[model samples]
Target: MVKQWWAALIAASSVLAGGEWQNCFNGKNLNGWTVKVTGFETGQNPGNLFRVENGLLTVSYSDFPNNSFKDEFGHIFINRPFTNYHFKCEYRFLGDQFPGGPKWAHTNSGVMLSGQAPETMEKEQKFPTSLEFQFLAQNESGTRTTGSICTPGTYVDVNGKTIKQHVIKSRGTALPAGEWVQAEAIFKNGKVSHIINGKTVIEYSNPKFDDGTPLTYGWISLQAESHPIQFRNIQIKELD
Candidate 1:
């Protein structure tokens, strides 16, 4: 009887440990999502930048100069909001660039958290006031890596080191510019752990970039910058 009890306890613990993660995007359609954006006129506008086909969430910019973000600026925020969770997604660079935009907009994409409502943004606003997990592809020399964090209204500490800067560039292996990379972010309390390709590139705590005004929770958003990017396998698991 004692042995059976112990076995049962272990099994239960294992199941609980594995049940913390949940899939946010169904890899099929934009069923559980809402979009807020100003735009041009087309089937591939900013509100429609994210699309699902063959179980992949593809972020394309081929119609940029034609349909999306041509004269309007906006963000497409996720319909749901989360506080403490583990968010994971797979992304890839499509190696397509635009003729005109900011210098960094060539291969720029990001996951915005703790962000404001998309409809509430200013007409000419550049970016939302939130914590941004910056995604960069190889510019010229392939120097950039994954797992970098850009704090718009937040900061974080790691191992007693409180970062006061805006960008915490991760020191991980450089992902190939045109390949798929697995990105993971562990959020709990006010801390974050940035993982890329199954490797932990950066860990931060107590995030607050707004001059000590810490943000505990907000919405999640994906970037539709003037570049071609693709994402899939988006899922999250709530934490206790």
Candidate 2:
């Protein structure tokens, strides 16, 4: 059933918005983005954690003093928010995990969806109130799958049941590190879906805040958890 949805969506991937896809990252710089890392004010990029390198928007830890990441979870958000759209990107995990980060964050990063504005987050807020389209790669411990959904401060109904758990694994492909994988999300008309490498892994609907308000739209951001990762070819297309 999910495969059927994937086939339909990817078929429409090329020609959405009149055969035009909006390039989110200009590849030269982070001009249309905002940085919000915990323990730092908005726009203050500590340790040069997020930067443009080799024409890719990268997350690295090469500049941290004393090899400490300082647990400053970070995110770079597009300045403009979206309501209904298709977002796609290619991501890959890189070298070692920085010190001072939790084990769970190793090779772990995510794309924040329906998120609050960068400026609205607290100085020490761990994560924004949003739905996270999670990404994971293999580590020494074991193999992990990508495309799982994590709800930081929201809820959704999956398979006709309300799911309140924090993170739910998807029936996604398990690939190793160092390989670039395609990740995507579709949030249209109060329905949500996650796709990985052209496979539809999870689907849900009725996203609502803890306060019972329907969450139809918000900002989108890429995560900078405690790992070395790079993102490229980030693009989005609005659905009507």
Please give, for residues 17-56, the per-residue lDDT of candidate 2 as tens digits: 4235889999999999999999989998887889999999
List residue ranges in candidate 1 displaced over 4 A: 1-19, 37-47, 65-74, 209-211
Stretches off by above 4 angstroms in model 2 are: 1-19, 140-143
Q: What is the lDDT of residue 232 in candidate 1?
A: 82
**Cα displacement (Å) at residue 132, model 2:** 0.2
Most accurate candidate by TM-score? 2
Best by lDDT: 2
TM-score to native of every candidate shown: 0.79, 0.90
Model 1 vs. true fold: TM: 0.79
Clashing pairs in 2: none
> What is the C-alpha local distance difference test score of each model?
0.67, 0.84
